[model samples]
Target: MTILDRLTGFANPAAALRRAVQLFDSGRPSEAFPLMAMAARAGIADAEYRVGRCYLEGSGVPPSRVEGTRWLGRAAKRGSADAQALLAALYVSGLATSEAVKGPASQRLFEQDTLGEPDFVAARELATKAAEAGSATGQAVLGYILTRGPGPMRDADAAHRWYERSAAAGCAEGRLGLALSLARQGGLAERDRIADEVRRAADAGLPTAIYLFAIFTEHGLGVAGDLAAAARLYQAAAEQGLPSAQFRLGLAMIEGSLGDLDPVAGEAWMRRAALAGNVEAAYLLGERNVKYRPPDYAEAATWYRRAAEAGHQAAARALGSLYLTGNGVARDEQEGTRWLRTAATSGNQAAQVDMANLALQGIGEADDTTNVAGWFEAAASSGDLIAAFNLGLCFVKGVGVPRDEGQAAQWLRRAAEGVAEAQYMYARILRDGRGVAADAQQARAWFAQAADGGILDARVALAEMLLNGRGGDRSPEAAVQLFERAAAAGHVGAMFALGALHSSGQGLPIDQVAAQKWFSAAAECGHGQAQLMLGRYLAKGLAGERDPLASRLWLERAAAHGIVEADEEFAEATSG
Candidate 1:
């Protein structure tokens, strides 16, 4: 049976109070109200507090904030800490003590004409009484007001004393207040020692304490780190409707920053927090959706727009990219440039680089090297590799910068890490002695690295150097291997080099068939000399079986492409 059922049998104030609590917990505030009212009429202080709360919240009654204030005033006089704090909050926030009403405040009965006059003076007096009556929350709140000095004299010392007393009474908010008061200097306790106090208050069911306790657990502040435990606490606090907790928990779940990754749950939490105006959550949701497998650009734009409206610099840049690419919205270069400018003003490094690119390409604005260099320098200083490459080029050519090959090499060297183009450039500077002493050995090393890193031109250069022994020990065999690799990556020069190598028999055992095969491959790629050579090989059976028709056809095809030797050879063959 419900406590109310048994309490009705007892017909006593104590039983009535207990029954009211049970009903309130059961979400039956209407039922609890009558019992609380009955006890309140009998002069029970705690019951008076319950009556005031019910009226203030309009539990099973029309809302009359004026009447609620009156009841709250009575409860405060009866020494209810919550009642005192509520009244004080109303005054501190400058809420109309008696809110004007229109109709249907059914939960708390309020009358339009009976609106109570807003009274800061009464609120201040009630707060004093509540603090003197040992309300920890009231004392802490009074301490905050005293320290703030809103229309009064500031008293940091008195505020600290009140906060200390509130904390001693086991109030988590009081503990936080005291910590903040001392933070102006150091703190009341060492960082590790304060954990105990916070945990104790959290155990007593304080929201702020619970959040701090979760943080301590996550980071091992004063306890062994336990991220899963922290996540559980975050989940609990999020369910309790804490917005900041919801955003953090959402991120943790999304990134699996804590144990038990749940992307779906994480996204749901982010949506909840975002809807509640959490800018970070909004930005993260935008980032997540944009990077999702197969990407959902439209959805990402919606979230990005929300965060951008709140002045998130990165979101402005991201949205601009989407606009420019026509990924989520219509392609609009002007719009994109506008957003890039916005982010540039905030000194967003990537956005600055993008702006530089836009200016250089003449896409959104006129191509101007001065503007481009300025933007590139801004981004490059932030260690952007591509920006460094572009900036290096600018220094080398005096394009929007002074001609300083040494500076160019400096930036190029920094950008040479696994970047084929940069590697090639660095190697070229070293090999040619451009604004520096030529180091053929170093150049060869860089050329090899760049070739392997996938620069076809570097591969050809390295192969030629190897064949001629210009940079290091001559190795025709190694040169042949380099040519083969470069040709495989579609370099026409490498293909020609391979044909020459096979024909001369410098790298491997002489094989006429192999020579013909290399020549044929090069000829197919429109190498005129290789075409003539292949035709001669076929005509003389030097590389394969003699076939006059095939040879003639090859020479004729080569002559059509304006190869001078092939045309002469064709005329000679035709006359013979």
Candidate 2:
């Protein structure tokens, strides 16, 4: 039933292992696996290592780390340097063991036989032993540990030495590591050396090397820029299960940067990368689901949760927002707060602001002014203008901190450079000499900027300044234009100003009829001064036909509004 079933029996395990090596080298892994298993059962260390590799890679069997680790562990105990080095590599790559690996419970006879977490200390010891035994892969593993392992283990010079030794022994991973190290130095000679070494490693079929070479080609880093060639190399590495390469190829295809838009293939590749544990790919998938029309919010949440669990700050923020709003997920205030706090603690400015607002409004937490101000300060210090503006208001109103006019002015001034509300507030501070020297010119300038930004209150203030010549030269015409613009936007004070301007002929020819019309408009908007003036005008019939009843009604309305002058007008109209 198998290749080994019809073959003559090998004389010994050594002979069988030799034949298996030859068959495997010739690309007949299926035929080699039978012999390898036979040799492994006879306790041949190299055969055990090979069988383990076959299981891990699914070369002649379904991939199973639990089975692979069992074989590798046996060979390692038998002092097989290659097996020790391979186990070290697997541990470093987070593939040594996992609870996800499937097998019969009966198969897990020992603790180590079960797929469990990797142990870095054991990985380092195994790699050191194999390296001392002159295994090139072991040397490469040491280089990787020194270069990318935990903080205390990293040593750039030591990594370079290990990589150099491993490369001399002809390890593809060593060549790739050495090339990447040389690339960091950056020069023509280093560039050429890096390219040559990467090319050799890629030729040896190292997926990471191929991916790095593709990046070089794409960016013209150490080779001539060629997008087509880079795309081909990306595809090659992606097909070989390189998550980074898959991500790059997917992005390129999705954006049509490779001259062929294949959204179906691109999305499939993206999903593959995400499934392969590419955090950025997962986040990108979440963004795609959320940003498109008819958004699949549930799918977005799934991707976002994956990325967030892997420590993606933006994904955490987005997922938190979804939970808070019950979008695609049930509204869970506690869960939302937890995720948002994670994002905020990770230095996400927007999350900090969101958290602050939630605290202020008692949405997910009790209202805490101090906590709100602390969050605002954190975001404001990081250059969030909206937070800076809020912080300024907090200082001005003593909402969270003691009201300090000086601090308020300082914060408001920073926000005023971009925020219209802050500009208006800052201008008012300058005009009133609040915690600063009174500078009408500066106030007017800021008011003009705020007005241009569509602050109606700023427009009215600027118009008044122009009419009174408080900041610079008087310009009645400019004042009248500003007042009219504000009036059109429904500013009651602007209407009253227009009425007074027309009555006094300060900006235009005296037109009592026009004055009366503006007064009536302002009075309707509850301008008490406008009501009193309109009442007087009606009582004397200064602008139009006298109507005693109308004059009495206007005067009574003005008096009710607390305009003392309206009392005289009411008595005059009643007596007439």
Candidate 3:
């Protein structure tokens, strides 16, 4: 028989519904809708259910939730299995209720008081009716709700039975629900099997199933880690314009573990997802642009604004940073502080640290040590290295906290593990025996490490220690070598040290001409000591002819750089 003849021959409403299901399954929901609607109007319960589904999901027409609900209610009243199941699921999920619905009101009657009550009994009744029918989707939905025991409904055994029945019907969602239940029961092997079955169903083109499968693969919950596969599946779903899938795909691409790193592409996908109302994608895109130097700051600011509108704490913090730094926007410290406070109160670590700094510096208002300390504490607790270093400084300086050497050392140690500044400070503490046992060798080692990591102060401290034999045996020649290396890298202290050594004939043969040249270079680099020494050489005509005017200029600049000796020498030179 032809397909149409077979469908016409079926007098059973259920059979007619099955024909419509076959049409829907064949990607002809448009054709199936009219037939389903006609059958529903003719008192065919299953047809009523299918028509409701088409309207509810907008598969073949403009969506009409009211019409869908009316048809589903009619089918449910007529004992249509699928319709009853869908209604049960909706009620259990609280999706059937209006968003403005409130809990039952409390009342007092003649001194007896009644508390507000949940409408769980109504939900349970719907779920029970659906579970009694041979609807696997209904069974799974009811099982999930009952197992959670939300409100007054609590029946683990019934949940387990329904889940098992649903699984037997080849329902992928049912299998996943059963797997979760098995996992809770410590049945790892069975849980894995069920999870695998769900994955297979997902591979067979179930939209929700594909999403769950991608999640499992991404997290390696039931399968080996397969981020590439997860990304592919997410991309597929995203191409279909699923907002959640778009966000997931964008995130994976941005992170670059699943495929070739493509920040621009990731940002593009995230932008699309954000426009689709994915708040997380908006937040992530905003953060990436703010921290990673995106090509367009205005676009990034727009995304940040969207996320902030959606109440994303990190995005608010990022927006604040842009405003504070005048990055892609005009500087506005007050607006920046306002946004930072919002994020800081929401426990955003970066915002907390920034808020602390702003408070300490009185950036937008009067300085508040108490508030600054609180923000620093919050940021430090969240593992912010800068905050930890600042906390250590506060302890050492008695800024906001009482001067406690032990606490200073503790916080410094934490920061020292990550920050060059903190490392230098901690190394100084070791060298000076401040709140800790003196360890010269340890101090030298840390200083060297910090210097190598580009801490200018650490480089100077290490060079000084070597020259003066503070932490190790004296090595004037080695100190000169260190100074030369640092000086070549534009370290002002190193340049001054090199110039002094040359002028005093301490490490190598004294060459007056060479000394003059080294001092000139150092002075040009703003080395105050070099400027003063060079000025004296010029005034005395030691390296060349006397040039009083040039000598005075060097002395004046040296004095401006806080050279006390230069001030005295400049006065003497001016008088002469």
Q: What is the TM-score of each candidate against the true structure?
A: 0.60, 0.79, 0.63
Distance from true location, Cα of 195 in model 3, Å:
5.2
Candidates 2 and 3: which is better by TM-score?
A: 2
- 130: Cα error in model 2, Å: 0.9
Candidate 3 per-residue C-alpha lDDT over 401-449 given as tens digits, one digit per residue, 9 for 90 to 100: 7898888888888998888888999999999989899888889888988
Stretches off by above 4 angstroms in model 2 are 1-43, 58-63, 97-118, 184-189, 255-267, 285-306, 316-342, 350-388, 473-477, 499-520, 523-576
- Could you tell me the C-alpha RMSD of candidate 2 in Å? 5.2
lDDT of 2 by residue, 1-576 (tens): 154542532557777888878878998888888888888988989898999899879987777677887788778879999999999888887776533223443565343533345556677888888988999999899888888888898888988888899999999989998997786656467887898899889999999999988988888977899999999999999999999999999999999886589988998999999999999999999999998799888999999999999999999999999999898899888899889988987888788788877765666555445666777898888788889998888888776689899999998999998999999999999999998899999999999999999999999999999999999999988999999999999999999888888899988789999999999999998888888888888878989767778878889999998777798778776786
Ranking by lDDT: 2, 1, 3
Q: Is candidate 1 or candidate 2 better by TM-score?
A: 2
Over 4 Å off, model 3: 1-62, 70-84, 92-95, 98-122, 129-138, 148-155, 165-176, 191-206, 210-405, 414-421, 437-441, 508-545, 550-576
Between the candidate structures 1 and 2, which one is better when assessed by lDDT? Answer: 2
lDDT of 1 by residue, 136-191 (tens): 88888777777764556457888889889999987777887776676654643466
Sequence-dependent TM-score of model 3:
0.63
Best by the TM-score measure: 2
Candidate 2, position 87, lDDT = 90
